[model samples]
Target: MPRADTPGTEAAPGGRLRWWTELPLILLVYACYSAGRLLVRGDVADAVDHGLAILRVEKALHLNAEHPLNRLFTHEPWLGVPADFWYASLHYLVTPLVLVWLFRSRAVRYRAARTWLMTSTFIGLIGFTLLPTCPPRLLDAGHGFVDTMAHYSSWGWWGGEASAPRGLGGMTNQYAAMPSLHVGWALWCGVMLWRFGGTRATRVAGVLYPLVTTIVVMGTANHYFLDAVAGAAAMGAGLLLTPYVLRCARWGRTRAVARFGPAAGAFTRRLTGPGSPVAGPVTGPVAGPVAGPVVGPVVSGGCETSAGERFPRQRDERPRSGAEPDASPADTGDGAPAPAR
Candidate 1:
């Protein structure tokens, strides 16, 4: 058997070490979602009205729902379904997965990244509370799209007059549909996972998730093509803002490190000066007593008697810039003083 400290096992302490690393953020995320769902909990009537307005604009011009992307959710199995299970259940898995990636990867910022993920979800939920609208399926009185969620009653959960809920236990939101948060959250999770997941399987999971979620939402009748677009907009905004947030955080960290102080400049000393760690092996301006020809003071040198006291000096015999430059040959000037030859 392999030791506990082996590579895949105990050898490394993952981000799992944090108490919230594996599960707490998930609860917090769901709590925010549940709160949004609560505020918008009511008859599906208003949602239906809002979604119809969207259809009006689409039909007003000759250029609308016939567009496959818009009708992507309007087709047979596509028109009448709900990917709510995919949307809801995925919440449990993606949270932990993000934690594992943060622990493994070096390029990521753990605390700030987590903050962004949760903040984006909260923002989406807020949109839900403020602009609740029913999806395409409930629009049977309006358009011809089907309701996949209602059709697959045995598979997942969805609500409204078209189909009843199993119980309040699984209920999330019945009318919040201006933006499809299922799509937004899925996209957010996919991005962070792809950037930070250590294993190949984990990385691939990131790519496939959003694609699958988009299809599931449309197939289930819980969203229109436009809802997915709106979800994507929210997600894109969050991701774009992440770097600026992280940059501020990193700047704060550097200031903190400065205030906390360093190791008395020992590391700094090793990185510079004549006896530096990199001084000998790598070639550079060989700092010494005498200045070399044209290139200033970069050459080999030796010891010499200066006023009877022995001291190291440059060996170049070029001129009276500092001292004798040559190492082997005895350098001297004219028969005269020759500048103390």
Candidate 2:
């Protein structure tokens, strides 16, 4: 179990979890991800070059899965329209839904899961900033890949530029495609369901969700095979680093408390006002002191006490023979009690 001071460990008073605190943290991370995509719009020429380079490598390795899948989706409207919806909607919808489910149902595992997701998202942001590659759909027409989201724009709310709503595509960066977070987030959701979700239905959904998401990303021409591979790799790296991130957070929290706890307590007391019960010294009636030592009842031999008795049971001091034992014996044992002097 994580310490209460650790990030994501506790939010509400008395170390209880609260959705209000959690929702803001999640929203902040997502906002940063969105802002990152908008800010790190790399040069179009550079992005295109990077995308073409990936294509050549995929060709050499015989991993050109995106082309055939893109072609099939392009030709079949039935498949294409739904794939666009999955691309535009489920990527945002399902991941958060799974997160909410975990928060509500699997509270014990929620912190670690949320941390892993946030860490992976930041890692994906780094990939976008460093090596922005244009997605397959954004490639030249000669590449023979169709942007299904754009092709089926009439059937959905998304615009031709990207998955963003109509007239909002300009806000999105079409070239931040080196690591597809769509697939990465889907994989995270799948793993969470598989590991923490105890039902057979949830486990099945877990397996299919990521698999179908990978297909949808490629079939929609939004990502190459390598892009999907990189996304999974980013998640793997995030999983490996989560423990260390948590440890660092724990250490920092410990230091902060050690350094500022007293001051913080004082500040809180001031805020609560001088008459606040917690800030004021405790007061009540006082009992007069006793004159001498107060002793508890003594137990005779063979008398069984409760589990946590401090003193051992005394030995029996009965007069076994005709003579009576001394009132205050020097020793009490199985042997004869000490005789009077």
Using lDDT, give the best candidate's number: 2
Worst 10 residues of 2 by lDDT: 285-294
Clash totals for all models, in order? Answer: 21, 0
Report the C-alpha lDDT of model 2 over 1-341, residue by residue, as the tens digit.
Answer: 76544345543212346889879978988998899889999889999999999999999999999999999999999999999999899988999999888777767677778889989989999999999899999898998998999899999998898789999988999998879998999999999989978899989999999999999999999999999999999999999998777666554544455456765433342322234432243243211121223233475756887865555686655678888766676665867778777
What TM-score would you give candidate 2 relative to the actual structure?
0.76
Cα-based lDDT at residue 42, candidate 1: 52
Could you give candidate 1's per-residue lDDT for residues 99-133 as a string of tens digits?
55664443225555665666666667777777778
- At residue 238, give the lDDT of candidate 1: 70
